[model samples]
Target: MNESAFQAGAARVDITPPLGTLINGDFITHYARFIHDPLYAKALVLQQGKTTLALVIVDICAMPKDLLDEVKIALQNETGLLPQQVLIASTHTHAAGSVASLLLGAADLPYRQKLPALLIESVKAALQHRRPAKIGFGAVDVPEHVVCRRFFMKEGYQALNPVTGGLDGVKTNPFGDEQQIDRRVAPVDPQVSFLAVKGLDDQWISVLANYSLHYVGDWENGTITADYFGVFSEEIGRLLQAGPGFVGMMSNGTSGEANIWDFLDPDRYPKAHFAKSELIGKDIAGKVANALQAIGWQEAPELSARYTEVAAGVRKPSAEELDAAKKLAAESQYETIQQVDRDALRRIYAREQVLLNDYPDTNLFPVQALQIGTGRIGALGAEFFAETGLKLKQNHQPYFTITMANGYIGYVPPAHEIERGGYETWRCRTSFLEPGAEEAIRTQLVELLKAEAERPVYSSYEIKQYER
Candidate 1:
């Protein structure tokens, strides 16, 4: 590696709500009454020569596109970091305050307004605390904690989808019986990767780890929690014996189709949500702790980042699709939009966007990729299945992909899965990407990973700026 000067810093800010904050990821909303643990926004800034890059992780459901653009604009104005240079990702903790403004989740306006500033402050704080630091990278397969929630139904085992009110060929857990289940729709991503940055004194400044296990579900009844993301961070920090300035972040990987449900061993989660959360969280911490111990630290490894974007055509409703969606809405008893189930919400969102004919035959968004330390970190603004991450990791071992980064477009299932017709493919307003959209995106991302240029093609990198 080329010898050069390098500096790193990390900072955290509490974003947890005090009380009476809207909570979701469920079908309806309620006020948060208890704090399982506080939500936080953490940032890591790295500087080498004149280049600066920021990677932020927020403990929340999902950051809408507008919120991400707002934070990017604010950081650009304050820190002079280009839009591409800064990547802000959500930890995807469903129990935290809502930033996503779609069905099953709603944005807390006050929380949304304060979010950009807090995120910007984090970037600034990390910059201010920058000091000589060393970086290291390591990853291990830890598939035991996660399982694919989608299952192929055994013949004669058809089940009704709760959200869409349609019979599903494959049953998502909570709907199908184990005796009726054929096999998992797909495999889980077992790889857990960690990137450690330490100060000259040999104490950690920040440790960012990525995993494909979906959020460990448990927080409910307005108990604002950060799920396993927060738990893993705290447990790992303690195990590592991190110093004062240390900030540890555990980000959601490509877990769009994955969940903490272990089909083979259903008895493991027989308890409550928080209890089950701790069981899975500590297991992950144990695996991460062991991985951290075996890593060979690097003093000043190479660091480079690139941001590229492309517009993949949005899947518009065919006449049959439009007719089906219209039928569902017309049959619904929901007198108001608030009462519309999440499944119907998807159909309506798609219909409205198409009726106006303005969603662009294509949806354009940014994909952030950074070649740092010993591997490359790639981020997309859409929800990708574990298969997506697995494909990206091919020939790019140690490569990590963070879905729902920058902005949330919806689920981008592989073409084969799309054909399988599961809830993931149920084109809701949130997951309205066209059927072929996933292939288009994967092609673009693969090309992006191959591009060796220092400066990415910026014209295509359009940050979708708009309002609800």
Candidate 2:
């Protein structure tokens, strides 16, 4: 392969915060206790022809929409690339410091302050590391790691939101009574895809992977971990015996409603959180290795990026609705944390809605499409549901989405999910994007990928042979 035809570079920058930085996984505040593994902002730059594409995956909870836009604009100015050409996404690791300036946690100012500079530096480093490389794209179905957390419940036993006490659309878990769960609220995309770039020396440069399972809660509270995001890279590299300077990243997919919870078997086997994360980490790495064996590596392909912004209005509650929510919040009791935390967060956002209505508010949703030869990607600024992702893949071949991309707008569930009523669509501050946002996102993504792509042709036998 003539590596000069495909130039790829990868770099990583350490971004772990001070030990005391507040962690943002739960309702109660948590501070970084012990950093088991360092967090990083990993970058990969690909250039084919004159077009260039940049991807930065930061290990954190989320990056606010406005902040992400600001970063992209600055990066474009410095690097002389169109703002749309650079895409930054978060790993959505709950145990890491927060960049999501809303909801249950406040942005860790110290970390947030240095984030933009360090991220841009990572990209520049990658550009400096650029070398002729051979790239391959492959997907492996790892269904066992993912489970649909949201469940439609039995008629009489519908759970209630803490604030509204209104019917909870679906039970996330059946609370040990698995029989009460009627069915999964949505479908899951078990396909975990990777883009592997290797230098002319046949050494690994970078491996960019995506999966839909939410952050593994095993590393919650005291420990600051990247969850399984970094583990995927470390394990895969070790298994493949990658050379030095290798970078691996597992970005968050549309997993707002997807998790590792085995709801069907309520009484789960007892295991420590890190142990669980390790179990999942190794399993996923193995899948990546298996898929890599079958990938048809290609050289010299087209590169292009399409970015579009959609104006989605915020879903605001009426004056009367706000007043009712405040009253319920006041009367609500702090019962079990599961119930109490839900009620408290809902109530807090309910008040936010009242205060926000004093002024006009509209959210700018950014959708990005990246084309790297046979690899196609959809990057979104919101925590998208699994069904929405499945829908996108159904429409476009060889495409997957990276969530918390550029920015995060909480959870974006499907239309039916919004109607079903859950924490994700309960008219809260976190999930305030107005309805039809899903359609807008889907409509634009379809337009970008509908064009003739640089997909590699494989024989019929190769296609069927890869589907073990």
Per-candidate alpha-carbon RMSD to the true structure: 3.6, 7.4
For model 1, how does the per-residue alpha-carbon lDDT over 1-468 read when each residue is reduced to its tens digit?
222578889999888876887776654566788888888899999877767778999998888777888888878777788777788888887777776655545678887787888889889999899888878788877877889999887788766544345677776664426777788887888888878888878888988989987788776678888888888888888888887678989888999889877665687674775987787777778887888787787666566666666676666666665676576656654334455445555545544434424456767776877777667788898779988888888847568887778888778888778667676776555656766777777777777777774674454345433111
Candidate 1 runs further than 4 Å off: 1-4, 160-167, 174-176, 319-358, 460-468
lDDT, candidate 2, equals 0.77
For each candidate, the alpha-carbon lDDT, in order, equals 0.76, 0.77
Count the clashes in each prediction.
3, 1
lDDT of 2 by residue, 363-431 (tens): 767777888887789889888888888888887667789988977777887777887877677666567
